[model samples]
Target: MSQQPKSSDDENQTEMYIRVKRNKTTYFLQCLPSEKVLQIKEKLQVLIDEPVNNQRLILIQTGEVLDDSKSLADQKVENDAAVALTLRKADNEFEDVNVVKPDDYIRDGDGGSNW
Candidate 1:
């Protein structure tokens, strides 16, 4: 039997996940591509005790500053995308992108030799 093609609306409604990173921490968020940036920030607010207004999200791959008024789809943020989360500082300036990779982690042993 042949399967039916998925409609655009169906694709938009499909559950997707994105990784929100900050420093050495990563937050995997379940979201639809149709969700707005502000919505994502609100979700992050729950996990992090930070206000949405103090948070800024940037697409890691494109280095594009995500607009709170725009949808993830509109920003071309697809499934499994990595987004960097930065918070406002005391001076009211957004912090720099500081996503740390696994390679940056320092092991207790020298040269990562377990043998």
Candidate 2:
């Protein structure tokens, strides 16, 4: 009787070591078996000292944003998987109040000052 070959699980459990790069620094993230992508983001937030909402993490191979619902295992993150995290530029950090100074209003083409 011939014995069946060992399953993938039995042969070797694959591990994912995610590396997140921000600015000039790189943070290493070691994920547990079956860990989700969102979890990795959370870990990166702690290491990078940035808000989780402001980060844009993508799979280098697929170019897809890491979805919270998707597991790292499903993403096929192996030991060599290269994950990159970019800090998304914040929109309009300075508010446009449209404050018209009294001097500037007089310089305008509108004859509001004379009226």
Candidate 3:
């Protein structure tokens, strides 16, 4: 007799990750498609020490600013997607997207004289 594979909990089954970038940093966060943008910001708050009110998430592909009240799926944020993270400045303005690509990194072995 043939048997089907066992399934884990629904939460684990629908788990996915997204790469959130800010400057030279990237955070890999595990989230569900149904999760709201605010939820994702809360997770970032713990890691970045920034309050959700001061945080902003933008989709890198389309330059769309994510609404905190909407779910990831509702905004078409699929798994393995890249999102830009911006923060509110003291002037109460959200900073521009500032993600740095790998090619932007300065190499140390540029053959400069140590002396």
- Which candidate leads in TM-score? 1
User: How do the predictions measure up, each by TM-score?
Assistant: 0.84, 0.59, 0.81
What does candidate 3 score on TM? 0.81
Which 10 consecutive positions of candidate 3 have the poorest summed lDDT?
4-13
Error of 2 at 53 (Å): 1.6
RMSD of each: 3.4, 16.5, 5.2
Candidate 3 per-residue C-alpha lDDT over 12-85 given as tens digits, one digit per residue, 9 for 90 to 100:
34778999999989999999998999999999999999999999999999999999999898999999999999
The C-alpha local distance difference test score for the whole of candidate 1 amounts to 0.94
> For residues 1-115, what per-residue lDDT tens digits would candidate 2 score against the true structure?
9966868664444455776654445667777647777777788778777776766677767766677667776766667566667665557242221223346446567667653
Q: Candidate 1, TM-score vs. the true structure? A: 0.84
Candidate lDDT scores, in order, read 0.94, 0.64, 0.91
Query: lDDT of candidate 2 vs native?
Result: 0.64
